[model samples]
Target: MNGILETILVIVGIIWVIVFLLALFLSPKLSATKSKNGGKK
Candidate 1:
């Protein structure tokens, strides 16, 4: 049970890392678009 939980936590951590990296990579483009759109959502 402990090992399973550890594995799940590790997987979740990896996914979070990937998402964070993706956000970092796309943030510039996103900001540019937001600026082009006058920063409105």
Candidate 2:
């Protein structure tokens, strides 16, 4: 049970790291895309 819990925690941590990195690295790209639209609907 303890081992399983550790594995799950590690997996969640890895996913969180990946999301954090994407947000940091790709935020500029996302902003650029939105700005190109002049914030239109």
Best-fitting candidate, scored by lDDT? 1
Q: In candidate 1, which residue ranges exceed 4 Å CA deviation?
A: none
Per-candidate TM-scores read 0.87, 0.85
Model 1 weakest 10-residue run by lDDT: 32-41
The regions of model 2 sitting more than 4 angstroms off are: none
Candidate 2 per-residue C-alpha lDDT over 1-41 given as tens digits, one digit per residue, 9 for 90 to 100: 99999999999999999999999999888888888989553
Q: How many residue pairs in model 2 have overlapping backbones?
A: 0
- Candidate 1 C-alpha RMSD relative to the actual structure: 0.9
The alpha-carbon deviation from the true structure for residue 15 of candidate 1, after best TM-score superposition, in angstroms, is 0.6
In order, candidate lDDTs are: 0.97, 0.92
Clashes of each: 0, 0
lDDT of 1 by residue, 1-41 (tens): 99999999999999999999999999999999999999876
